[model samples]
Target: MLAAVFHENGGPEVIRVEEMDAPRPGPAEVRIRVEASSMNHLDLWMRRGLPIEIPMPHIGGSDIVGTVEKCGAGTVRSLLGKRVVVDPSLDYDWYRLARLRGYDGEPFRVIGEHTQGGFAEFAVVPAANVVELPDGFPAETAAAAALAGVTAWRGLMTRGGLRKGDRVLITGASGGVSAMAVQFANEAGAEVFAVTSGSENVRHVRGLGADHVFDRTTTDWGREIHRITNKRGVDLCLDSVGEAIWPQLLRALAVRGRLVSFGATTGPAAKVDIRLLFWRQLSILGSTMGTPAEFRDAMDMVFRGKITPPIHAVLPLHEARRAHEMLEAGEVFGKLVLDPREARP
Candidate 1:
């Protein structure tokens, strides 16, 4: 099996493609022969180093779609040879109780963060993490859409309490999660507003069903959103670009509105006025990856074609470094997929 491994944290040059042993399934786990994997901002963050130190020679990728090759003892034997996608969120011991009752628990662990992930020919995961893919669903499409779609669904529906007739504003319109957020909000019968970096992406966001698109490069998008809403402000603001947009996002939120966040693409530190929170009675919620139940509900929509994933580019698996570069440089409009079958030697 060939996998992309990085021994040091730095730039793309640190990532190397080399042969590695295929993983085997443990009890309660399944071994998957990976067909496709997708890149996420989390991949870039891990590669560049975060506050925590990752093990040396790490393989990074979370979104995976593949076929089940083997099931460990006690696993469902009926799942072998089936096409599947993984729910990468790992539950803790205490959280197991919540999981058994179909409720989510805190302190969730994401795959590729605390453990090995699907950047190679074979990866192993708990049987509970696997979801069967519908017939005719492409592996690459499922891999590309899984994480982002689930994230958007959890952010809008679970955390933000998005409802029909609500006005939702999403920052960074062309990114994978933002694009999904737009579509999900629109499908929920909300008026969608998208803030994109350039004119080139305005049409793309609109096509995703955003009712209003603002060019963030040359416009005060928050002000534009306020004007569009007649100064009432948007009911919800999904902002992942932390520091650069926090103040503006605060201004764009309607009174008693909620702002849901998942990442900080534009630096983490922000100086926000305390008065804004109290006076507006705004709620700030932080969300991570979806729970198993949320992932299932979200993927159902994708499998049924209720929402579509936008593929920016598909590259060979060995080109993981270039994919990271593209994401870090913000050159992609949506998810970038890596086809393991096409990986270079």
Candidate 2:
């Protein structure tokens, strides 16, 4: 099996394609013949040196769509040969407890963070993490859609508690997760507002049902958001830009509104006035990836075309380095996919 492995954390050049032994499933696990996988910002974080170092020669990817080649002994026998998408969150068992109390047992044990991930032709995952893909579903779309979609779904529906007639603001609208957030908020009958840097993506975000699009490059977006809502601000603000937008987003939130965040793509540190929180009665919620059930529920909408994946580019697995570079350079409008079959000899 050919896999992309990085021995040192640095730049995209560190990632190399090489022949590696195919992984075998353990009991309660399944070996997937990986057909398609997608890149995420998490992959970039793993590629660079984070506080926690992955094992040297690590493979990085989370979103995967494949067919079960074999099930481990004592695993459900019926899963073999089934097409499936993997929930990359490894904490399937503790998700309930975590959601109830905000307890993520250990930060480093996430898939592609601690263990090997789906960057190769063959990958092994727990059977419980597999969500059966509908027949005739496009594997590329499924792979490109799962992780980001699930993150947005959980953040909006479960954490943010978004409801009909609510106004929601999503920062960084061109990214995969924010694009999904825009669509999910709109489909829930909420008015969607998007802040994007590029004018080209304004129409794209609008096509996803965003009621208002702010050009962050040209406008003081938070003030525009306030004006659009008649100074009431939004009921929810989904912010991932971190410090760069934190103060502005806090100012843009309606009284008692919630702010849900999943990642800090820019930088994490933020300085906030205590008065804002106390006076506005604001709720700040941090979300990671979704639970297995949430992942399945989100993918259902994706498969049914109620929301569609926005693919920026698709490359062969050997081109994984270039894909990572594109993501790091912020050149992609949406998710970038890798086709393992194209890279095989």
Among residues 3 or more apart in sequence or in different chains, the pairs in candidate 1 whose N, CA or C atoms overlap within 3 Å are: none
Worst 10 residues of 2 by lDDT: 104-113
lDDT to native, each model: 0.87, 0.88
Candidate 1 residue runs with Cα over 4 Å from true position: 92-107
lDDT of 2 by residue, 1-345 (tens): 999889898999999999999988898999999888999999999999888767678988788889999899788989989999988888665756767768757542566667788888988888988889989899889988888998999999999999999999999999989988999999999999999887888878898889999889988888888888899999998988898889898999999999999988889898787799999999999998777788888999998899987999889999999999999888888799988888753
Q: Which stretches of candidate 2 lie over 4 Å from their true place?
A: 95-108
Residue 148 shift from truth in candidate 1, angstroms: 1.1
Q: Every model's Cα RMSD, please?
A: 2.7, 1.9
lDDT of 1 by residue, 1-345 (tens): 898888888998898888988888889999889899899898888888988756568888788789999999899899999999998788844355766766654556777766778888888888999999998799988998888988999999999999999999999889998898999999999999999988888888899999999998889887788788999999998879899889889989999989999889988897687899999999999977687899999899888898888889989987888998888888999889988888764
TM-score of each: 0.95, 0.96
Judging by lDDT against the true structure, name the best candidate: 2
lDDT of 2 at 125: 87
